[model samples]
Target: METREKILKAAAEMIADDVTATISVRAVAARAGVSTGSLRFHFPTQRALQDEVLRRIYQHFMPNDPLRDRSLPARDRLVNCLRQMLAPAGVGEDARRAFKAAFAAFIAPDPSEQVHTAYLSYERASAGRITHWLNALDDEGAVPQRDRAKDVRFLLTVLNGLAMERALPYGDSVLQSETDTLYTAVDAILGTAAS
Candidate 1:
């Protein structure tokens, strides 16, 4: 692999392996098997290096901007997309574990600029997707005319709460409860009954 890519992958793997990883330049250099001079040459600054790594970290959880898919019913599509905001990136147990690990790092208290960058990126991406779906719903007259800004904020707030709740107990029942709660809130917001 290329030197710069190696360094980036090394840093990303560090966070994936240990959410508490320091990711200091020296440490990343050693991990990547590159010299500090080479790492600096590619990264310019630690902040820059971290920023790139953060982008990769967020990539695992953020779904393909679901706003682009229009094949299904708008409500179904919107709900599917919203669910994807917190849903596993793939199927089965490993996907869930990977998502949990990635998100744990995202949510863990970290004062680093990299964490801030990753957190804000997630917010911006998810918020943009939410706004797009809301606009589509409003256009279809499914949602009553109102402050879209407020609705977007409210919907995302609820979804973020659900996403954060995953850090709690792990089990089929716990996941089902979370899913039930999420759909309940979403149905209330979008006016659909589960039954």
Candidate 2:
């Protein structure tokens, strides 16, 4: 890989650490086995580097649109689409780590422009996923003729609630129960036509 790519990879790996403590350029340089000056040469500003790292993390959490099989059942497809929002990183461990890390940055006392941008990007991506799934379901005649915008917001709210439940100090069974409940709610919300 090129030097820039190597630097990005190293930075992304650092962000993936369980702690997700502030990732400094010096630390990233050491991790990449590159000089601090070299890392700076590639990313002149600390915010620039942080933005890149967050971008990479968000990318890791994004799902592949082309890979989704639209031919699947509506409920199955809805589940698949909803899961994609969190599945790219992973379902459990990775999800926990990524969420803790990103949410920490987002809720920073005074978020920098870069951090704010990353947070907004995450929100948009999440909303887009839900909108995509709703459209797909609507296309299959599984959705009612209600206000789509409202439905999207509602689904997002439900998903966020479920994510919070997952983040709580609960057992795996609790998480599974919440997930199952989410799907049932999603099915009902979509007015699923599949029997």
Candidate 3:
């Protein structure tokens, strides 16, 4: 592979192995079998490197995004995209394990700077992705324009709640409830009646 691709692959591997998703220049360089100067040439600052890594991670998670499909109703498309965020958490034991790992890494005790930075990076990337979807809908006149930041925050909050719900004990109606909640949130943000 080329030098830059090698560095990115090494960094991505480190992030995948790390609970906190933190990467240091020296560590990444060592993993890539490159010098610190070479890594820095590709990504001058740590923030720049982290941002690019997170962007790639987000793209990997959201390949073939539903937001690009205009054939579906706007509300359904938005809710479907939001549902994708919760899909990884699974249900029952899988969801519990995911939450447990997250707590151990980020919440059991006070998080260190590395953990905090990693969490914020993920959060920002998620919000940015949602905002991009909302923007696209707005551009197509499928959704009304409003306070986009507020709308994004609201949608994310709903998503987070729904993700947590997956870890909780619930009956067969749980899936229906989740779908209803997502539809309600999207309709509210779009200033339309719930479908």
Query: lDDT of each prediction vs. the true structure?
Result: 0.70, 0.68, 0.83
The TM-scores of all predictions, comma-separated, are 0.49, 0.55, 0.68
Q: How accurate is candidate 3 locally (lDDT)?
A: 0.83
TM-score of 3: 0.68
Best-to-worst TM-score order: 3, 2, 1
Candidate 2 clashing pairs, residues 3+ apart or interchain = none
lDDT of 1 by residue, 28-146 (tens): 99999999999999999886786567655545554564544667555566677677766754334555575577667776666589888777666665665576567557657767677
Candidate 1 global lDDT? 0.70
Candidate 1 displacement at residue 81 in angstroms:
1.7
- The better-scoring model by lDDT among 1 and 2 is 1
Off by over 4 Å in 3: 1-63
Q: How big is the RMSD of model 3?
A: 6.8
User: In model 3, what are the clashing residue pairs, if there are any?
Assistant: none
After superposition, the stretches of candidate 1 with alpha carbons farther than 4 Å from their true spots are 1-74, 89-114
Q: Mind giving the per-residue lDDT tens digits that candidate 3 earns over 93-147?
A: 9999988887788788677887888788778667867876786677689778688
Provide the lDDT at 142 for model 2: 80
